[model samples]
Target: MDDTPREEAGDEGAPPGGILDGTQEKSAQGGPPPPARSAPRRKPGKSRDHSAKRLANAGLAITAPTSRALGSTTIGGQLSAQLGTVAVSDTRGSVTQISYTATVSATNFTTTVGGNTSTISKPNISYWSGPATAVSGVGVFTPGQLAAANAIALTGSHTAFAVTSAVGNTSVSWNPTIIVRVPSSAAAGSYSGTITHSVA
Candidate 1:
């Protein structure tokens, strides 16, 4: 008889390849995979500016000629010398207020025949607008009987004034009438005085 021993099938342990789920078993020595890692995240903030600008302008025109003549009154004569208008525009984008003023360059009138011994003054300073669609009573200064130019205050203290965007020429316009007086007991001579305009 042969002296060889026979072996059984369930001899040792689990299958050599690994469990059926299919992840190859790590060698006993190798460590578990590093914990799952994910990228970092962030949140963001805000910014800005607010402001504005200004613009304005104005001008004067004599609707009537610059040269005017006056007639003498037996007692105190009154004559209209010149007629004119002023236009103001405000693009400043705000409601602005505007006013007018005037001054004589010379303190008094100068004439050939003993210039009337007096400071620059007028008898009447009347203001009116158009014959078409006039705006009445926007008057400045006084009229009739010895109006003084000895520093007249028809002019406002403010050099620059405000003009609202709503005001149109239809609303207001300047038409000044300068009247002079020569009392019966006055000097006999041809006198001349310059009426100047100043704005505020």
Candidate 2:
């Protein structure tokens, strides 16, 4: 009477295998274990920089010369002439103002070999601005305000006398004198005229 289901008396070593081979396998649908994949947080490696600037401008210049030859005089004699130095330099970048004008071709003093004339007008010519030396830059003109006894009387109606002005970046100098008075009814040869200077 054996029904074939009884091996329980004193079970011998037991490894005849197959109840899913002694079970310990998992995950057909687990929770909270899918969020441990943290290897993608490495995006912090970038850099940059840029900058630039510039500003520049400076221009203008002037220096006048030509008047040094008046060798003889005597006729109610009174002479003084040595028209030299009249300098000005402007380094302009952003501030500027300039003015100087002087002219005279004939107020008197003429001789055509045998037709003499020297009956001067305008108090016998004299226009001066001598004594001003500031050899650098910025707003110049000092030394008794360009004095030669502060003279001004040069006419033949060739009027343009406003000789001084500068506000920024300016070098300056001065010396211009001409005093002649020989009108004892002057009548002789060798006489000429011309003296002009300008700036703006």
If candidate 2 were superposed on the true structure by all CA atoms, what would the RMSD be?
52.3
Write the residue-wise lDDT of candidate 1 on 99-123 in tens digits.
Answer: 3322222113323324435222433
Kindly report which residue stretches of model 1 are placed more than 4 angstroms away from their true locations once superposed.
1-65, 89-107, 114-172
Candidate 2 lDDT over 1-95, as tens digits, reads: 11213222123632221000000111111212465765555556743322221112224434444324443454555566655665545455335
Compared with the true structure, all predictions reach lDDT values of 0.29, 0.44
Error of 1 at 100 (Å): 7.9
lDDT measured at residue 25 in model 1 versus the true structure, 0 to 100: 11
RMSDs, each prediction?
48.7, 52.3
